[model samples]
Target: MGSTVNMQKQTDKVNLFETQMTMPPTSEKGSSGNVPEDDPSFNPFGFVTDNPSSRSAIQLPETPAEDGNVGQMLYRTEDKGREFGSTIKSGKLRWFVRETGSKESRRGTVVFLHGAPTQSFSYRTVMSEMSEFGFHCYAPDWIGFGFSDKPQPGYGFNYTEKEYHEAFDKLLDTLEINSPFFLVVQGFLVGTYGLTWALKNPSKIEKIAILNTPLTVSSPVPGLFKQLRIPLFGEFTCQNAILAERFIEGGSPYVLKNEKADVYRLPYLSSGGPGFALLETAKKINFGDTLGQIANGFSSGSWDKPTLLAWGIADKYLSQSIAEEFEKQNPQNVKLQLIEGAGHLPQEDWPEKVVAALRSFF
Candidate 1:
């Protein structure tokens, strides 16, 4: 009888162990018994979903508690875009312009044009550094971006390449920037447009420096642009407040520090304008045509102006070979300086290295 009872108990213990192992995961006792959606520790699977309760760049808390958070106030100035900038009337539109150097700048004027989904904010440090060197630096929040006016896509501003070119020209005229200026262009869409603009008016540009922008026909179109082409999805994707910062992080080797991330995220949080503007611009651009224009425009004999390829070797988008090919095409004038430890947006990734290259080249 004792043996039989002991055997039964052993079987019961085995059954209990199996039962515990096979049981479904659940939330804490106070909550519903469904599998916990967040907190990997609460769930047996040890994986958490992208829910708000989790901390990530996408779900960054807008307000971090601090007595005198200079980082917090950084966004209030629209990422220092307002403090270092002013609004100017250009073609009946107001452009939020960042001018670093004095009117009587000793070095020549330098215009920095940023790519899509990003604004002139990327150039804040670069511009500041460049200005100190006596180069009159101007970085504008392209209309519908940053602190600039975001007009609806109809009457005067259509967000087309032509309209952008026109608006830019008018902005230059309004700023009275007539002399040939050194140009630093980077990123996508509008960045490529800047190159095309240079091609169209070679006489207006003294020298050009290109960062990690797509230059070849084979350059792949990023998913952001592709998603923006979809009807409903595009609209939804564009509205993401964290889009710009995410894009930068996705492309770069280093994660953006929260302080810097806040600067990039500020514009999108303020209004829907930057997102819509980017969406319109993305959908309207013909990548094939634009890439062809850039490839051919800057190829061997076609491009004469001295050019510098301050390429970020770690760029997730364009590879080093792209720069190598372009340099090979124009071995004489097109100089290539591969920035190590940097990614797609080299200037933002390592401005000191970029400034070093610029100081040497320009």
Candidate 2:
């Protein structure tokens, strides 16, 4: 969700944390590089920034008051979300999670997984609305994003697909989410990781709901991600504070209000952890490889779980046709619900419609 903004303005922004660490070498592939040997992260091709910036702790500062209206204290920027959330210790990572409804709720359990450059914050309204329907809902910011612990890559946690899946599994086990539960996944890299996770553990999933994530090889990679794959450029892209705002607005027909936009920029402004985490993740994923796995894994015969394509027709990144094509492959189990006015981040662009669709489908 990182955006393209002037470097000067970004530096002028207030510093949120005062932390430091030794850089790490390249994680998986391309361990050899011609870059200077003095670089803390030795590999020449590593996405490690020339100089890692300061970052704040996992705890957030005082909440901003909700002066406007859209109901339910949107985006979890206020006290409603602060006191409602708690940190869960899962292995070496600490996950910041937002819970709604009691764990014993009868309707069923729903685990919400958000995509990169964003956090569980996007699911604030959807989870809130869904909880009122008597379902237990939990949305955790993925490792290295949001209020969750952002471990340095090659440190305790690497941002590889395998690592993400493993971390997520541990988190689920820690939360005692053993019962087959409904899974809602959206966005890129980590978002698609959610789908791949479900594919690997089909027995653990009751039903699957997909948002505007890359489902096929045809799904386009946004410029932000593509740009972040570049050597020097990727480092700069990770530091941008308005990544979420630019990503959402770039694909939508409307602009985000100041209030809503702040929620998205809050993390990036406060620390360099989330942004650097995104950079490492972007560099690790081979879109073609991942998309191929998603397309073929969820194809008709292999996938038996009930699926919902609650897609946003207005998504400039992945068009409505992607959903239509996916539905055709699994006609019996996959249901496509096209949301007319929503765009790339439908949960943020049009949550009411997303909630309604989830209500009917879940």
Candidate 3:
């Protein structure tokens, strides 16, 4: 209760959108490559580009594909608003939730938390496959990312570490998404945030699996992520469809298929772009301080829960030594698995291997 109140007070401390970020000056400047910006169906807020010259951004599909993939579903007002009424009632966000597997044949529930700039769409294939193995999987696009509500600055969303953790906790409570579920956390801030939450609510978590997320600052920030935190350049890259596409491609050792890449792009481009949300989220990342807190949280407490550190050897952003040392320190219950030929987004690059790792862990 104290934490909840503290988080609320923190939210009141800042004006999220005081920094002025304007849309590209002209329709030609607005388009991301060959993707038409002036189309009648175009949503300026949907996909974006910082590249003033039409040469740089990737050309995204004019419209989303019609065929529905497995576990693809939108959050209707009645279904998602049941417990967390305020989030839905605000009308600023209609969060997306993806699920696979049935309770009847469920082995266990696995909650997947994606990192910044990416939603649950990152785990679509992984979740569907895990369902075949008898595990019920759930992945939600965190408030700002994915199809969730992207509240601009003046509205209430602060996009802080505390805010995200609180929002996720409230979502679980409101939905009655009980514990005894495995938590798979991706990226740095998210990994730390989820770890802290699991430590406090140990009863709910079955195990913890971390992928390409550094728990300390010894690892340098990747160039792409670093750019996201820079002022004008960061904002430009964050909203640019080409840069985003390149980041995704570079993060993985495997080539991403066209359709899958589009899925990742749609959310950021949705509604004239979630640039404000992206910038707010990037500003919260303080590796030196935050990583220390996470390391302390893991070290000071007795983490008897099983933890798996799956590192991608080819990852340019996160260091492999950190993962090695983490497992070295906790040999009793922690296991470090190096995923070869995989980069940051292992789920996308090597879903088969990722699935195998989960199955073995369970």
Q: Give the candidate number with the greatest TM-score.
A: 1
Q: Give the clashing pairs for model 1.
A: none
lDDT of 2 at 98: 88
Q: Best by lDDT, which number? A: 1
Q: Which prediction has more favorable TM-score, 1 or 2?
A: 1
Write candidate 2's Cα lDDT for 90-158 as tens digits: 987899998998898888999999998888887887888889998999999999887889988888888
| Global lDDT of model 2 | 0.76
Model 2 CA deviation exceeding 4 Å by range: 1-83
Please give, for residues 294-341, the per-residue lDDT of candidate 3 as tens digits.
565555246778888877777867768888777766678789888876
Per-prediction TM-score: 0.80, 0.78, 0.72
Candidate-wise lDDT, in order: 0.77, 0.76, 0.62
Model 1 lDDT per residue over 30-75, tens place:
2523333454334332211111111222222322222123333434
TM-score of candidate 2 against the unseen true structure: 0.78
